[model samples]
Target: MKFEVGDKVVIQHSNDEGEVVEIINDKMVLVDVRGVKFPAYTDQLDFPYFKRFTEKKLFPAEKKPKKYIDQLPPEKPAPGKKKERIAQLADGVWLTFLPVFDSDEFGDDVVESLKIYLVNNSTLAFNFSYTLTYSGNSDFNLDGALPSMQDFYLHDIPFANLNDNPVFGCDFSLMTPDRKLAEHYEASLKLRAKQVFGRIEEIRKKGEATFSFKLFDEYPLRPYEEEKPVDTLGLGKLAGSGFRIYEASNGAAAYGVGEERA
Candidate 1:
């Protein structure tokens, strides 16, 4: 029970080694284990000289070989080719919700949020405008061009937002270079809270990352129009009627009239 300052002692009933820093009384003394100091009874601590000598002789410490900078192993070269992104989505434009789970383990996983994506699975490029509304109020809006067979990340929606009745609307126009013009396709999706929960359950059961709804199977194209011959005469007659040609102005008005008729 005699513990003095600067004495290296082993705390009894444990392998903690500390140095006595102060003697509170004949029984309790302040001991510093590593950097932490605590009061301990003198009877609970003993000199570590015999224990240290016995351990050093019984279990000799193994010396590790010193590693030099020149002796270190060379780093391996990185791979030349990168992995390609691949997805086997159906041939349609899809609004996909990828659930981000709170836990990575299987079963009882909770969806933290959902990553929204506009997936263009068909062979058509489109300039798209997307909007998300909550409770009849616009919450998010994005505009971008989506390429064929690729997915565009819109934004993330918290899982709790499903209870507020969010509506996702998208308008798409073909990125065509031809003179033909088609009407912009508009699509909207609104899912109930129960429906979203059901989809989450289905995703968990199927071990899939995303639950998607098809927006459109095929992108609508402009109806084809038959080309007509240009009428060179101003006699108010059709070109196919074989009328005799007269003096006419071959300027912008002639081309404009032909285009308007076509």
Candidate 2:
């Protein structure tokens, strides 16, 4: 019955499959089916993977093997060219911008595409929603959770759009696993337009592999502060032995003692 957001499950009554989006309580959860979300009890859901194994018969169905084309590895920059840079956005989160190049049919001219990655590098897991903005009026959204030490690919931004909308900023709202609903932490990450665009142009002219920059390395989020422990040692002894107060004025002195009469 254990479940968390992003886990795949099959609904009991409908027998439809979907991902767990929100957990209401010990017995309830919300699931996303296609684009619609429905409330379902935890007891009514089963692991989708297990169902596939249970439904398969002893005899395997005959099917033709599908051929897959091997993808070429990303091209590497020349030895002297700059390398890729990874930037830390918040406490356990990292960001990086990359340019991927493609060649024309003749393999003479090059085309460029941009991609941004947001990585989770902390011990704790988190669910997050993000907004990336540029040009002052344009924006895009990427919503999902990244488990501990995982990575999420944002999207491919076309090279043509960079000129009109150069500078970019990202805002993220994250909820940690321990206090998923209690605390909503926010972080704002900014990437300068000049830096990115200049590098791209330089790499293009130099025929380098790609352009990269390292910014805001391991920037930390505001940490949670725990309460201090109470002092109990001396207080217990002082309560048992009571105390005495002595006052002196000029040459005259007065003394008072207090203790448990019993």
Candidate 3:
């Protein structure tokens, strides 16, 4: 509602979620991130957004129960908490995300649809739209297949692949446009996938699979101010096709669709 000169806030208008780097006059505060500065009016803002962390893991020589892992507690312990830390680290604490991924062999495809569901659903609203394009390459693998990285996401929240297919899913950076919903949604998504699929990794197609759509992010109907162009991303160099996110607003994002700028 109100922003002081030095408050760290996330702009709901866009997902940049930068710190309130400086106050410019009475009406605007400049948020700077990654060497970029954006000035926004106080009226179009929210403050004190949540922070995010890369997922970490802890392990002790003994064994931790699946229930504890299943719980997916918000406060993850370090490699050790007790002398336990020593024991956990002594033998060697290997942070293997693949181990968790390896367990869910069955939900591989489900993970795909789930992420598509979340993104599509979340961006369905009138305020914003997200599109998934290929930036560097098209196919994640030579076979034109995706990594199948045990696609898992939360429920209640919505997501979609602009092209209407999902293969690899990514994390929502902390200052996501809708941080609260994204976090809760991702948590529930993580916990539920772990529970239902178990740790075993397997691939199963839930519904008919087909490439029905080409992914695209919506551009502003008309540009108003400094935020000039929209951004897009493509698959990547590995896939042999390149795309970038582009709109009248952000101009062109590094990633989009096809071999050209989307």
Query: Each candidate's lDDT (Cα)?
Result: 0.75, 0.59, 0.33
Q: TM-scores of the models, in the given order?
A: 0.51, 0.39, 0.19
Tens-digit per-residue lDDT, 1-262, candidate 3: 6566567676564545666776544445556544445445566666543322222336536775557566776876668322111001112111111111112465342332221222221122322212222333333221111111111112212222323232332223222234233331111112233332443233223211111121223212222347644424433442465444345555534344334634
> Candidate 2, residues 193-243: lDDT per residue as tens digits?
566767767855864433433322343455667997775655545656875
The digit string of per-residue lDDT tens for model 1 on 147-224 reads 886678798888889999999999999887444556688989998879988988886686444688889898776788
Using TM-score as the measure, name the better of candidate 1 and candidate 2: 1
Best by lDDT: 1
Give me the displacement of residue 123 in model 1, in angstroms: 0.9
Candidate 1 versus truth, CA RMSD in Å, comes to 19.8
Candidate 3 — worst ten consecutive residues by lDDT sum? 84-93
lDDT of 1 at 11: 73
lDDT (0-100) at residue 248 of candidate 2?
41
The residue ranges of model 2 lying beyond 4 angstroms of the native Cα positions read 1-92, 104-111, 166-182, 197-262
